[model samples]
Target: MEPMGLRERKKLATRRTLQHEALRLAIEHGSENVTVDDIAAAANVSTRTFFNYFSSKEEAIIGDGPPRPTADATAVFVANGPTGDLLDDLKHFILSPMLDLSAEELGYTFTDFLARKQLMLRESHLVTRMMATFAATEREVVAGVAARLGEEPEAIRPQIVAALGMTALRFALRHLHHHGDTAEGAGAEGARAAEIAELRDLLDEAFDALRQTFDTAR
Candidate 1:
């Protein structure tokens, strides 16, 4: 692949700077107390520049908005016929975001931001607000998955699949966060690859266990 152009590199640097500074300020001061101007000043960029990247201070602190399947993943979902394995397809759909990410490209995974958010949850109401937002995001995921499956969003099967997929994702992320330091000795790329592999393994195990439980019950 071609290297990022100079302008693109600069924009990425600025965005990373903004995210780092926003998290730092939110941790130091309460998330409620931190303003767009505060984050911009901390990042040494104008507030206008911050707006260019993130619409809200909470978004800056959270690293980005809620995770969604990428367009490529969505296309794959749409193209998949009715005979495909729903669980496996959903797993790949959820995993698509982290797939093909080089270490340099993997700036601040959700686990990192979530760990920091836990620390700040004590003093700020942002965590509560974010949870509400996440619920809505989950609904959106349910709708997307339902559409791909040619079912209603509220259909029992689609809802169950979406909920299980999201739960597995969260479980994988938390597991990685707990075990992340095991990869600290590796090089950056190696560490990221290892983490992704570990997450996939954990997700597979979770899904397999769920399948077994249902099969045994039947």
Candidate 2:
């Protein structure tokens, strides 16, 4: 809701820089050949600074990612909420953390994110780290949904909502990957806006499909 302060933006910028360089170096020289020192030097930051943002080069390549909901957003969703509609609210709760922030604001574009994903596919070594990151993200979603429902995290309702939310996100992203708006000039504002719109529409379709499926079952 509130605009990010200069400090937070600066930190995000640094993190983005480190991640971009790490990905770039790994892609070029191969992840096996690249070290923390190489990524840090490429980013023009010291190894110590790199370590502050990421535990290792592999971690940096993954980025501070999957971009979980902020505490503020999660609290609002748990309490007041943007909307009382369960599916709609859960969609917003899961995606607003990303949709609310522009790619430029975060110092990383959607295209950059896709590039990181491609790197993960190329580097088998990063697979384990990526899996752990995804697992942590799922838990966070389950916890947020559970808190809102006043249910334990292991409860079926929270688990189902969390699973639906993640599936919708992945579906939207996969759709985006096939769409061409992001293939070139993704740095342009119009391209970025189109990408956002595409992702939002696909997510809505995915959730709406879920609603339809369940409504028919009922």
Best by TM-score: 2
lDDT to native, each model: 0.73, 0.79
Each prediction's RMSD to truth: 3.5, 2.9
Alpha-carbon deviation at 96 in model 1, angstroms:
1.0
For model 2, residues 56-106, the per-residue Cα lDDT tens digits are 788888765567888887997888488888888888887776666764643
TM-score for each candidate, following the candidate numbering: 0.79, 0.86
Q: Taking the tens digit of each residue's C-alpha lDDT, what string does model 1 give over 1-218?
A: 35679999899789988988888887788777999999999999999999999999988886754456666677777667323777777787777777756575553554455556575557565666556655665676687688887899989977888888888876776566433434677666666777678878988988888788888999
Off by over 4 Å in 1: 1-13, 81-83, 136-140, 178-185
